[model samples]
Each structure stands twice: as C-alpha cells, then as structure tokens.
Target: MTTETEAISDDALADVAYLSRSRNRITILEALRSGPHPSGRLEERTQASRSTLERILTELEERGWAERSPDGYVTTPVGERVIGEFRPVVTAMGSIRTLGEAVAWLPDEELSIGLHHFDDATVRRTTPNSPMAEATYLLELMREASVFRTLTYIAPPLSLLQSMRDSVVEGRMTATNVLTDDLVGYLRERPEQTPYWREYVEAGARIYCYRGHIPCNVFVVDETVLIANNDPDSGHPCEFIETTDETVRSWGRELIETYRRNSERLTPETFTEESRMSAEHTS
Candidate 1:
C-alpha cells in the first residue's frame, strides 16, 4: 500500500496549483460564494467571457467544487473550505510581491523564520514625496518607547540617539545598541560624537560591538519590531517593516541576544580610552 504522506503530497500539489493558477477560476468561485448566481451573473461578476466561464464551471463541477441547479451555481462545502485555505496563500504572495527586496535582502536566518511572521507586518516604503518616511517613523518610535534595542551597522540619527540617551540616563528607559566592531571603530574617529557615545554608555545605555558583517537593521522598541533596509549604492532608505506580532517580537528578542552575546560590552571608561586612541591614530 502507498504511504499516506506519499499519497497526499502528489494530489495536494496538483489541487493547490489548480486553484491558484487562474484568477478567472478563483473569481468564479468567489462570485458563487454567496448562495448562487446564474451564468450571466457569473460572467459579469467574474469578468470572464461566456466560453471561459463555462469551461471553468465544468472543471469546478468535475472537482466537486461547485454544482448547478435551478438557482444557477453554488459552491460546494469543499470548495468553500478550499477557498478559505487558499486565500492566505494569495495574501502572502501579495505581500511578497509588494515587499520585494525589502524582505529578500534580510539575512539568511531571517528567511528561515518563514514568511508567515511577516503576514501582519506594516511596510513603510520611501516615496518621492517623502524620502525620509521610514527614518522619521523610526525616530518617532524611539522617542516614545520605554525600551529600545537595535542590532545594526548603521548608526541612528544623533538627535534620536540623544533622546534615547536621556531616557536611559534618567532611569526611565532601557536601551541597547549592538554594532559591528568596524562600525564602532569608525565612530571612535569622530571626536565630537565620541564623547557623546561614551556618555551614552555611562548613562546606562548598553553598547556591544563584535566582528561581523551586519546585513540589515533591526530595532525593537517597546512591543514593536522594526526592520529597515536601504539601497546599497545610494544609501537611501528603501523600506521599513514594522510589526507587533508576538512571534516576531520573540524572534527579535532572541536575535538581539545572539548579537549581544557574541559582542564585547563597552563601558564608558573603555569607550573613552578607545576613542582617544582611535583619534590619535587618525591624526
């Protein structure tokens, strides 16, 4: 006898493809969802030609997905179930099409987390009319959040950093900024900003640096997880995807931990010394 898993996989793949390939067919099924509709109505609702509608209806009938009676055609129970199951697939595909590289450019581990976690995410893409949309939104979140964390190669805006620093210094917020060692070294060369960074550490901000290539920027503020991407060539914001889903939040928390665990914790005194040395070396 054929194994159950082997038996279902072949049939299931065919069935899923059957329903997903043709928008006309899906439209016909959806149009018939509310009770029944005559052929003329189906053609109008599905925007399918008379011949095409007839052909799809025949296929649907053969598949037990629909039946015709005096009241035109009505969806079978199985058809209803199939459509319900298939709608999420459509939605997820739509999301993928819309997000494009914003999702694809994420690290390999992020893709392994699967696409379902992103189903509920909100994407803020940069537009010609609003080039700083993503950055502006992230800055707003930073100012409002009671907890802030990031794993990024990109340094945040100084104004936003100052806000977070003040909150942490005042004991009103908890914050961490995890960066690659290369980024930290570069920051040390900026004499004006170096002292401010050291002050950030002294004021209870958690800063960690490690050797690695950071591919994307992740910021978890309060209960939200925000992932951002920028164009590699122009350094312009590409998109920012934000979500408050518990699963994504859990993944974000674990991701921060992984980056931090591999990093060297920088104290205020050590950071100050490192900056001084870096400045000397640069001069």
Candidate 2:
C-alpha cells in the first residue's frame, strides 16, 4: 500500500540514485545548461566518447529529460525543473569544503535553514596579507547605497569607518551600525578619534551596542543587497558572500534586527563618558 507521499519519496530517491550513478551524465547535464547542443557538440563538451555519449543520451531521453529537436538535443521542461531542484545541492557541495572555520561564524540554525539562499550569491575572499580587500569592496557597495545597515562582530577597518563618516557628513547615505561590546571598548582606547565618531552620530548615523556576542558580520545595503562576512579571527582566509536574492536579503535584515533589539542605543554623551572612564582606568 504505497501512499501518495511514499510514492513521491520513492521517485525522488530513484532520481537521486540515477544522477549520482554517473559522472559522465552529470557533465552532459551541466553542459546543456547553456542551451541545446547537437550530439557532436555535446561529445566535445562532455569529453565522452561516441558510444558512451549515445548511451547517456538514450538514458536521458528515456527519463523524459532529453529530446531530439530541429536544432539538436535540448533538455525538456522536466529536465529544467530537475536541474533547478538540484542547484542548491550542487552549490553547497562545491562551496562547503572551502568555507573552513568561517562556517562557524554563522548560527547553526540559520545556516541549516537558509544556506541555500546563498547558492547564487557571489563570494569574495581575502588573504591574510590582504585583510582589507573585502572591506574595500563593501565600501564600494556602500557608496552606491542610499541607506545601509551593518551588524558587525568586529570593528571595521579604520578606512571604512572614515568613509562611512564622510558619507554621512556629505549627506550621501544614512547608516545604522550595530556593534559588539568589544568594538566599543576599542573605540574607547582611541579617545582622539572619539570626536569623529561623535560627528558621525550628529550626522544621523545611529549606533547600537549589543550587550552580548554576535557571531557573524552582516551588511544590508538599500534593503536589496546583503553581505555576510566571517570573523577574521577564524584563522582561515576572510570571506564575504554578497547577494541580491530577496530571500537572502531578508535573512540578513532579520539578523541585523536581532542584534539591534538586544542592544542599547549609544549616544555621544554616553559614549564620551564611557570612553573617558576607560581612558582613566587605563592611565
């Protein structure tokens, strides 16, 4: 007695087994991503010999995925659907091995739930010697955004901090910055730069200090683009994932809001007092 749900599960398992059985078939399917191709062309692209290609093609046609067309062999609508369903799985398998310790910076629950939203995102990586590369890219994105929000686990590069201040000063962008307490302590140590941060406050950039730890860094620009960054302390190369996918954007926005809700607003007067007391303690 196979229920409808059980039938669907069986079909799905069969499809998975079929796809996993042959690397040659996978190559042919991926080659078809650009569009239809003649058997000869597919042979060249997939690097499968004629006999092997013909067998794969026959199997694909029987599966309702490949069809003979006036132009050549094209993937059918069913094939396209199958490819779409497998896209995130393919992307995850490709990227997961490279992510290293950076993967730990994201909440396990969030990653488990929404990691696929990152399938189409662009990743930027930086070497230890090039620590500021991703930050520079982020600044470029910020310059093009009218409104931006950031949830940061680490202090931003000084150059980027200055650029945000300049953008606020010039009335080019509005920003909301959420910071960990550790970053606030660092700012306190550099009292000389406190006035610039005050200017940032006056220029309409709001700051919030989260009472506890935030695992990753998120920047949402114009509510359209989201950038997720790993902690530099992770010992792996720093990396950032940028995406315009609306689902990913929403996820980033929600992460930012979570931090904001747990944070206390930081005003210039309060910040100055905090910095002064810290300076006194250190002196």
Candidate 3:
C-alpha cells in the first residue's frame, strides 16, 4: 500500500495535469493562488458560477492544497509551496526578452529582396521601379524569339493582340494560345478584329478554351526568365508578376505545367464551328 505522503504527491501531480489542460482552470488557480475567498466572491471574481467554483475548490482540497472553513476557504501550506514553484516556470514561459534576438537568428538569404531587368540585347534598368518597362521589354523579347511558347490564362488583351500580329508579320515566332471560355467567346465574335487568331488556327497553332477563372496570367519564353509578378503596380495595372529570378522562373514553369495537365485542347475544327456560330449570332 502507498504511504499517505506518496499518495498525496501522486494526487498533486494529477491535479496539475488536469488543470493544465484548461486555460480557464489555470486562470482560476492562478487567481486563487494568492489567497482564497468566499464561494460567492470567487465566483464573481473568476466569472464562474458558485457550483462550478465549489467543484474546483473541492478538487483543490482533495489534492491537499486548500481547506474549507466556516468563513469560506484558505490556502494550505502545500498550496503555497506548489504556487511558489509554479511562479518561476510561468515567468520563464511568458518572457519575451529575446524577441529581437530570435528574429536576428534567421538566415540572411531568405531576408533579401531585389530586382534585375533584362532587355533584348542588353541588361536594362536594375532598380525597383523597372518592373513595368521590364514586362513590356520581356514581351518584345518573346515576340522576337524563334521558338516561343505562350500559355495565357485569359483572352489575348489588345496589347497581346498587337504583339501577336507583330510576331507573325515579322516572321519572328509562332504562339499557342490556351484561353479561358470568356476569352474564346470574345475572340470568336471579334473575327475581323483578330485575323491573326484565324491565321494561327489555319497554320496549326494549338488553341485551348477552358471554363473557370485562370487564377493568374503568366508569360514565359525560351525557358529564360522574363516577367513574373503576383501584384504588379498601378502603372503596370495587372496582378501579374515578371521576373528573371530562378525562384520566380520555377514557379512560372510549374504554373504552365499545371495548366497543360488540367486544360482541354481546342483544335481548328472546334474553332471553325465556334467561329461560324458566333458570326451568325452577331450578323
């Protein structure tokens, strides 16, 4: 059989474990640790009912940390000792003295942010303000590349249309368009506006029309980093990113791969039927 002292120690440890599970219980215990009060006073102070306070006090009494009296309750010798030990542990856990020191411990590489811009034949501006110009320059580079691949998320906007026309007219590069359903509809009805789209369909340019919001707009060329922006500035007016950074380039490539894996392809035959129906509707 366990001795009275050993049994009391086991019960004390169990009480601590039980109280630790509830922050409310911990708060009540911490409040009562200073001293004890009447059931009504403790209830008011802790915002618990009298019955709940009595139950908790009963538990504390069973653990030999508190005693009931004619007046109400009081901390026992064991209770004072337990609270004294707990104070230092709680103090150590709560201290935020080294918050700055903890922040300083992070690696230097992860804390760096900068920009590098490249033009067709040379390095352009390498400042923070160069993203817009850099995006336009990168688009021009894709227009000039011999074997360019494009996977646009939305319809070809006017700027993109002009770029495609220039690319075809200059015999620079051919492009594959992976468009959203809305963009496909826009293209189908504006047949006269996008002769390049018709020409591309005729000349074996792969087109895909899908339904859903294409969460991002991305453009990549010849596996070299070009433009990657998640939140481009107002002058840029597009929530897209353009970058030559290795990290950004990998993200762009993964996006393209994911789109290819998920999207359905629309062939010339599909385009012709859709275009004719759109033309008849408009006419």
Candidate 4:
C-alpha cells in the first residue's frame, strides 16, 4: 500500500510538471487560483491574446485541468489539489537543489542521499534484520548518545521531544530548539509544566520566531551526524548518517552549515520575539 506521504509525493510531482510547463499556463492558473475568472481577464493577466488564450483554456478544460464558468475559468477540483500539492514541491526542490549545488561547489566530496528514510543501524553497524527495524534501533542509539551534548534543531515530533526531555532530565543531554512561532504558541498554553519549561529556557534552548514555511525538519547532532527527510514538503521517512563519512557526512554538514548561515540572517528582532514569547509562558 502506498503510504500517505508517497501518494502525496506522486500528486505533487504531477502538479509540478503541469505548473512548470509554460508561462501562459502558470499565469492562467495563478489568475484563477483564488476563484473563477472570466476568460477575458485571464487572457489579460497572462498577456495572451484572446484567441490564443481561448485555445489554451479550451485545451485545459478538455483535459479537466480547469473548468469554465460565466465569470471566466476556475481550476477544477483535481487541478486545485494538484496545484496545492505542487507548489510546495516546487519550492522545496528549488531550495534543496540550490543548497546542494552550493555544497557541491565547495571542495568537499559530500554525497547527500535524498531518500525517504534512513536506517540508523546502517550507520551504527553493517548488519540488519529488517530495514525498518534497523532504523528504529539506530534512532534509539542516537537518542542515548544525545544526552551528554547539546542537540539543536527545528520543530521535531512529540516523541522526539519526550526522548530529548528524558535525556535532559537524566543529565545525559541538553537541547536547544528553534521552533516556528506557531509551535512556540502551541507549547505556551500549558502552564502546568512550567518547571520543565524553565529548565529548557535556563539551559539556553530558544525558539526560532519567524513566519514562513520550513520545507523539512533537520536533525544535526554535534555537527557530526545529520538526518533529514528526502522531500522537505512531505513528512516521508528520514535518513541519517555520520558526518565522518566522506560523502554522506560532507553533504549533511554542508546543509547544517547552510542552515546555520541562513538562520543567522534571520533578524535578531524575530529571534527576540520568539524568546520573549517563550519566556513569558514558560517563566
């Protein structure tokens, strides 16, 4: 059975190819993105002549890519869904490829594997019983090691949060988080856990306050190992590797470095906003 993530990926690919086809197609789609539009308006917006635009619209309609109404044209349900799926894929592809190319430009021979998931065991040991099982085992190992050092990353799942918290409580680990504003807000509502919250804050864990979408969740431990999902937009499986691996480690390090550099570019004002918000609730 195709997992939800895989199905979404396929749909997203279809959407990307359709949208990336021609300027006119994109223009028309954008014009009608919000709602139905008259053919005349679409042509004007897309800068296509009436006759030419009509032909294109007719073709799209025939293919069920869009629908016509008295107002103008509207993306069909399928078309809308495709557009929704494709937009993120396009954005993520551009971001990831650009970062990858930049890494390649460096003298390092790093190989970034954009796979759905990584088996932790592959890095810890050579043997494996099942790929899935091995991956789980590897994650546990990483968690155990994470206790002694400071681990940092963007928004991770609740399970990860609990595991990190456990390590910190046991004096095995401390962590910093650069969470989106939304996530910060999410953790703020619960005041009962104020003590735990204080521990994170006092330990120097800070939220990343910004109002934008992050394509994927990244995990880098001690700048030595990096793990990230293949498609940033989709919550597919994730891959992990040691930073020491000539090829794999280099790519992972490059991505972390890129994120760090770009993250620094974030205005201090935004970071402060996040810190303030987190402090208010947790303190």
Off by over 4 Å in 1: 1-12, 18-91, 278-283
Compared with the true structure, what per-residue lDDT tens digits does model 3 show for residues 125-206?
Answer: 3346665665466556657665545455445446656666567656666665556777776666665545667656666555
TM-score of each: 0.68, 0.65, 0.42, 0.35
- Candidate 4 lDDT over 1-283, as tens digits, reads 9887766776656646666887787677656778999876776688888887988788778767789787768989877776666555555465444444222222222334532112221332223455455346545755775522221323444455556556665666645444445555555544443335555444444434334444434454543454443333433233433333344445544554444444422222332445557667776
Ranking by TM-score: 1, 2, 3, 4
> What is the alpha-carbon lDDT of model 1 when measured against the actual structure?
0.79
* Model 2 regions more than 4 Å off: 1-14, 20-87, 94-105, 128-132, 223-229, 232-238, 273-275, 278-283
Candidate 4 residues lying further than 4 Å off, grouped into runs, are 1-139, 146-155, 169-171, 174-176, 189-198, 222-226, 230-254, 257-283
The model with the greatest lDDT is 1
Model 3 misplaced stretches (Cα beyond 4 Å): 1-139, 157-159, 165-174, 224-240, 269-283
Global lDDT scores for all candidate models: 0.79, 0.74, 0.56, 0.51
Candidate 3 all-Cα RMSD: 20.4
Candidate with best TM-score: 1
Please rank every candidate by lDDT, starting with the best: 1, 2, 3, 4
| Count of clashes, each model | 0, 0, 8, 12
RMSD of 4: 18.1
